[model samples]
Target chain A: MIDRLTAFVDRLRQVGVPVSTSEVIDASTALSFISWSERSVFRSALAATLIKNGTHRPVFETLFDIYFPQMVGELQQEPDSEQPSSKNDAKPLDDMTSEVLEALLRMDLELLDRLAEEAIARYAGMMPGRPVGGRYYQWKVEQALDMNAITERLTQMLGGSGPGGETAGSVLTALLAREDATARMGELRRRIERIIRGRLISDRGPEAMARALSRPLPEEVEFLQATSEDLAEMKRTIAAMSRRLAARLAYKHHRTKRGRIDFRKTIRRSLETGGTPLEPKYRHRTNRPDLIVMCDVSGSVASFSRFALSLLYALSQHFRKIRSFAFVDAIDEVTHFFEQAEMEEAARRVRTEANVVWLDGHSDYGHAFSQFLQRYGDALSPKTTVLVLGDARSNFRDPLAERLHEIRDRVRKLYFLNPEPHRHWDTGDSIVSKYSPVCDGVFEVRNLRQLAQFIERIG
Target chain B: MFESPDRVTAALKKGGYLSDAEIATSVFVADSIGKPLLIEGPAGVGKTELAKCLAEALPARLIRLQCYEGLDESKALYEWNYRKQLLRIQADENKDWSKTEEDIFSEDYLLGRPLLDAIRSSDPVLLLIDEVDRLDLEAEALMLEVLSDWQVSIPEFGVIRAQRRPWVVLTSNATRELSEALKRRCVFLALEYPSIEREKEILMTKVPDMPEALAERVAEVVRAVRNLELKKSPSIAESIDWARSLIALGRDSLEDGEIAETLGVLLKHSVDIDKARGALTAK
Candidate 1:
């Protein structure tokens, strides 16, 4: 049994999840409390046993569901059946599962697994969903059949208008070419069509039953850009390394002085000085960066501000000065966030501290641009490099194209990194189409990989 | 010690450069501190190679522990030699049944796996704990005590401490983030994909038979193709493969014309091949 559990986990590893041994112990301990006589309950119990944190809860639940699927009758509205009930309509999802289970129990095990899958899939398709324009008639016909063997009852209900008015069987035959694994999956998939509920997973992704048999979630983290301090440190380190002279620097040039001066350096310096009486001056050097950065940490783009701070922290040693600011409806200097004892805490304080009336959390770039013009347009000189990270969605407010036009004149380069996809640029409050024109460079950065490329390009 | 990012790149320029960086250099430090090194990287980025190379550098025997899900101390440490135990049991069956249980559980019956094998070996060994991510948390936690002490406890043997604590190297593709408890015990190194220049150097070195110009073109094509939205990008191994495939085919320049069927050389996934094919023909 331990070996079986071990094999079970080994399979989970074969997928993407990393399971440690303590979790296995916790799962086994949890399993001891359950009665395996009931498979669904036992499955839930095993999940309860193995998984510890809330973060891993969904993953464990998914794995559990995949491993020990409830048989048709087993999935009935008993105490622990995993049949998901819609908040609106409570009862009887798997009438077919129970019907097939009742029909198949004590029958052939292989046949039971097969037909139950078919009937369960069919039942799954009829599960509640929003009205698809074409599927309404099919749903209605199915609803009729479900209501009063409505396939048969439709004739009387229709007052003999037309007998051939899309029978359920003909509708099924006409639509979705349902056959073999495609038919099975098509049925299963239609049953588990993606929820519009705005969540990462619904019970609909592929191999749900297989994923459910395990303990917890898979690992997926992308590290494209470092936290701001780390980025800053990398920048600083790179700068410091740059000055060492990859091959050689003529630092020890000879100097030939008047009366018995240095021999080697005296002669070398004399050559540069036409072998005249000259002195060799030694100046120690380390690589460093000479540049200016204009960062926009406005509340609209606050999600990345934390990382920006870390970058600033890392580069604190390399640069002479870094001029940073935050804006909501308006731009305000908030470089003090990096200077503060706690960067996150400071950002919070700044958010509250500078809650000026114009600076709204929801974006208003027109006002922000106008404020930049009146307040600090002179600061965006040609030597400065401006990096703006935001959705560029100004919420249907004025696009304020003229102000960006003026600021573009002052800054040497303006780079834009929008988190939103390119297609969504002109959709709603998005000023991406308008803003893309003024910026020197524009790139979509939805993940770390893109961000790393962006940083490398800029650096 | 890896001072410049360029130095790291330069280090990776050679052929057989394993992408085996841990969570931080702490793993490197721990290895230097004479503790076991736990290295976790994706499947093909060469976690095992780091140990192999390090073993070569150190000139020590590489003792590897291949971890599976249900890995236990009995398997990782020492297990009773059942054939020997059974032979003894049969031999002692008629002599004295009373002392049979104790006699059968003696050290003579114990057989050593990698963990115990590393401990008992007179010479220094590189104990590679490959794919630590596959093992459950309990196994990881159990590993902590041994990792710190360089010893294993067996009731039969009383305690089997390392005669010469082997250099332990653990690897993972990050199926899960290791616990802080386990992490604190080791040094770290986070391996990332190499840059274009470094990758080019790697290609030239790994496939020395490859034409230099062809290798450069391949690296460029790989980088450019990688820039597009594909299912998965070509890894370092894939770069080597594409070079080898090209070399075997006796092709030097990657003509725009050759990309259609030769896309299988670049893209691994069918969808990616189709996407690349579409892009190649798009203009």
Candidate 2:
């Protein structure tokens, strides 16, 4: 049991979930207390001990299903006792099956899809016993469809000049003429494989399916193209990163600074050593600089804004005060929104209700800067650090370089985070170069790694 | 020590804390192995309540150390009573210097903090270190040392091992990530908001005088409010308070206007209250 638990932990670690040795021991101990027969109870026990962050729950569940499969017991109830005899049924080649074969032979992808569902269901039932894996099941289904034979039939039809063969010949000829026939074949193979895999998942469970569909590393996933699930996973990663950053900052401050020396205590200690002075202490300073975050929450850079705001919000405790603003063409003071709601909720509300996006639906950095200077300019001081997150694409409008320069002069530092790659920054509508000259630092933060490096440098 | 998870559940329930199978299993395992249990969750999910309940169930002395920023070993573990030591040194001035010095640094001059007290206690102890995430990394390191070894190493008096292994429960709101070293030395339990059914039971138990329908309505509303993106969702404790408030007002079922009026009992922030009000009105 310990070995199994350790192995499961190892898998979790492989999938980027950090699990300590003590956690492994705790999970094993926790397992001993639960009735192992109750799978949900057992799963929850291990999960509570193994998973520290909520984001890791999905990965942990996937790994759990893989390591401790409940399918073996489940499959026994409805055992596939029938032998693998393709010729046992009189209508062995059902109407849908024959149509699928015919469509494959004729290179009719549309018709093939129409019949593929029924064909897959029939093929799944015929395959006795638990599937070895998704890939093997895919291969079995492909073999049952006889893809090679269909390819050969198509080739033969293309080679012939017989009656009714001309139509098939033209279709096969057109398919062969395409430069991406191999790619098309690969797509078709994948589609069939998905059908087979989907059916197998219902029988065995989603664990095998999830294992087959690998996810990109959290730090590597691009923000703009990320799905909601990826965004959620990134949020967890950001949360963990922020916690570590806070701890690091606290440790640094704790190590570098000392509390004020107690003169009375020093004198009292001196009495023990005959008026010898030693062990001086200095006051612990809790002073943190004010932070002002200006984010671009327009269509192009919303993901980056969300992530940056969340990270900043998580570290809000470390700062004296953090005022956040979101803008496209207009600016809205979202500091209160963030302060009033949780990070997730605040981000959502900012998107929906902050009214940062103008009716024109185009990002106007010049307008946003002028608005910020007009309304919240007094809030800036020499002690404040202004952080801006945007792609700097202002739709060919006036580049508000001078307004930013004025704000930069008032603030201690102005750091701009551009989600676009550096190569594309100066091109198109992006006026990053215009603002880069006036800003203290312009970091091309395309992913979390760059974001982390930038954050560390600033800290 | 719990013989099974069910026994742990029964004991905790009898102590007025409705625990699920996972919590029961974790508590039982921590007791059986004599290791500390680290409970982490969002704020007000009863991470601290679990410790209190376990202490009540075990019928042991509950020694609590509420952690915060700048929490040091002197405050959490042990501190030498310097003034007492100094006075004793002055009083023993005529005596041999080394003898007096040694005497002043002994256990008599050592003021035991929560950790030291739990370790030295002969009675069964449930040491609840609340909000462990608030402690600085240095303080956390100090705690890790004592928790892992079940002993504190004082330079003058040497190591003081626990007479009996205390049932330690460290709770964190996850404001910060705890060090792996501290986490590894304990059993881990992640407590979340209870399900509606479990929460209803909790509301009823915590507010027995409240009507059953009112309790169910409070649980349902609290559940709905939690689902909304609120700044601070009503915790189980707040749900009980909400139920009690409703009972005090002579209301058996939640009314439309009253929900808007009484949302303050459940939600702390005005923004959250507004959001909950909007959601309730929309429903």
Candidate 3:
């Protein structure tokens, strides 16, 4: 049990869950108090001790299923001679359709489990040492079961004459029954999937299953490579991340603002308080830097620019003054879009509403920089920090490094954020080296983690 | 003090908190292993109520420390009573300075906050740190020593160890991520909104006067509203409050009119109420 626990901890850490040594000890200690007979409690014990963050819970649950499965092999039910013919093991596939419908209608979980196991055994082609992904097995089982027909039959049985000849009360009853049927179908599907997953994990040692199944965390997913689902999840976390960033930035500012206590003031105040020195004063620090962000919203780096602008817009409360501009070959300020609507809406509006494109819509960094400096030259000051977000691919245009140098001279700090890989910096029309000398910092931020680290460093 | 997860479940049920086996198992393990339990979830899923229920189940004295931004050690852990110390110094004028210093820093002049009070209590103590994620990182760091070693050390004074280890339960709405070192020492329980059946059972337990059918209906409607993408979903507490309000208004069954009328009890936000109303009517 200890060996298995340690190995599971290793799997968790492999999947980016930071489980410390003390937590491992706590988990082992927690395991001793619970009975292994109670599987839910056993799993809960490990989860409580091992997992902390809520986002990591899904990964932990997946790894937990692979490590500590409920049943090892074909689950053995109690043998009953009285009802042998009706048993799932003896029943043929022809009778299974009705049996499955009946089991689903009754919501008999054990019967569904047995049916799922039997269906996988016959249909999933689960031979020893067979190398196949778990989803293929699940798809096979799903195909064999004809789940759509079963659901249609179940709905027909549940709907009861199609609610045509029903009263208001019976209509409500049918609606509730249909809802229950949909829930049961969902449960049936989940059970089949779990059974297939368990069979594969047992066949292909858990290490390989862990490798095949583990997904990159939302923060680790590259902005350029993110799916729509990943982008939605990232959007959901952006608000919370921004709130945390604001808190951390405010805390750091407060800490710096609290300078060392003045002994002279303390002594002066102590004269009135019988030399007790009860009240003390400190030197107050000042100045919050202004920020101006320019994002290149060309096709290649559009997603990266969207995320950067969304994060900055969400965190606009922390900055003293923040102005955001979106550009392709032309530059236009889109800060008002953020103020009028939410972050996602603002991102969408920046594309459709902002007049950013001029001539062909390839990313012409030289043209955009010159346009920005021409239009907003007076906006830059010594207390301002400017961040340019793009891949700096000038598309064989003039490699205008001097305009960036002029912008840098007017600002306290100038930084460039390139979403492309570091190795891909100066390839082809990429002119990052020309701008690197003028910029204070040029960071390669391909994913959310690096973006957050960069912001924390500069904030 | 819970012998098994089953016992924890039954005790919590009796204490009027209907928890599933998972929550029961976590509470039991935290108790037996002498580790603090960290309960995190969305707002109003009963994370804070879990700590109160555990206190009631154990019949222990509940020492609550409500955490917020800028809540530091002097407010949470302990602080020296400066006025009392000053009086002691004034009273013992011309006495030996070392003895006076030692006399003022003792237990009489030391003010014990909730954290220290829970540690120094003679009886069994259940320390409930409510909304712990609201605490600043420095204040959270201050709790690591007390949470891990069951002791607090002041530089001027010696280490104040726990007389009997308190069962610590920290609740977070997860507004901010907690430090890794603080989380490493504890057991974590992520409490979500209860399922429909569980919510029905919760309604029955929390408001016994409501009819079983009506409780089931209320749970189903709340679950449906929760499925909608709204600003704030109705929490378990809101469900109970809605149920109690239904009974108070003398409504036995949940007609569409009844739900529409009392939607305010379940949903706090106007936007959520409007969305839930549209969904409920369409259903």
Q: Write the per-residue lDDT of candidate 2 for residues B229-272, one digit (tens) a residue.
A: 54467888888888888888888877567888888888887767
Q: Candidate 1 docking: what grade?
A: incorrect
Q: Of models 2 and 3, which has the larger DockQ?
A: 3
Better of 2 and 3 by TM-score: 3
DockQ, candidate no. 2: 0.20
- Give lDDT for model 1: 0.53
Residue A443, model 2: lDDT of 95
Local accuracy of candidate 1 as per-residue lDDT tens digits, A1-459: 576577666655555455667556645654554346655445433433343222344555444444443343333332113233332343354454444333332334455444433333333333433223213433443342252232232232222234454433322122211221132333323332221111111333324334433422212222133345443333322222212111011112122222444467656755643456455534323323223333345555564554444444333322444455556677776555544333345546656775433744677777777787787666676556666656777878898888877777777677777766678778877878788888888888654445544644543
Report every candidate's CA lDDT.
0.53, 0.73, 0.80
Rank order (by lDDT, best first): 3, 2, 1
Model 3, B183: alpha-carbon shift in Å? 1.1
Q: Please provide, for model 2 over A1-459, each residue's C-alpha lDDT reduced to its tens digit, 9 standing for 90 to 100.
A: 777677777767776777877677767766766678988778877876777655567667656665666545443333243223332542455454456546755668777664554445446443534546656656666677776654444444443544343433333233332212333355567566645544455555554555664465567677766676777767656755655454434343544555676687677766654465644544466545677888888877766776767766655534437788989899989877766566777778888888776659789998899889999999999878888888999999998789999999998878998888888987999999899899989998877667666755664
lDDT of 3 by residue, A355-374 (tens): 89899898888888899999
What's the TM-score of each model vs. the native? 0.38, 0.72, 0.80
Kindly report which residue pairs in candidate 3 clash with one another.
none
Query: Candidate 1 vs candidate 2: which has greater DockQ?
Result: 2
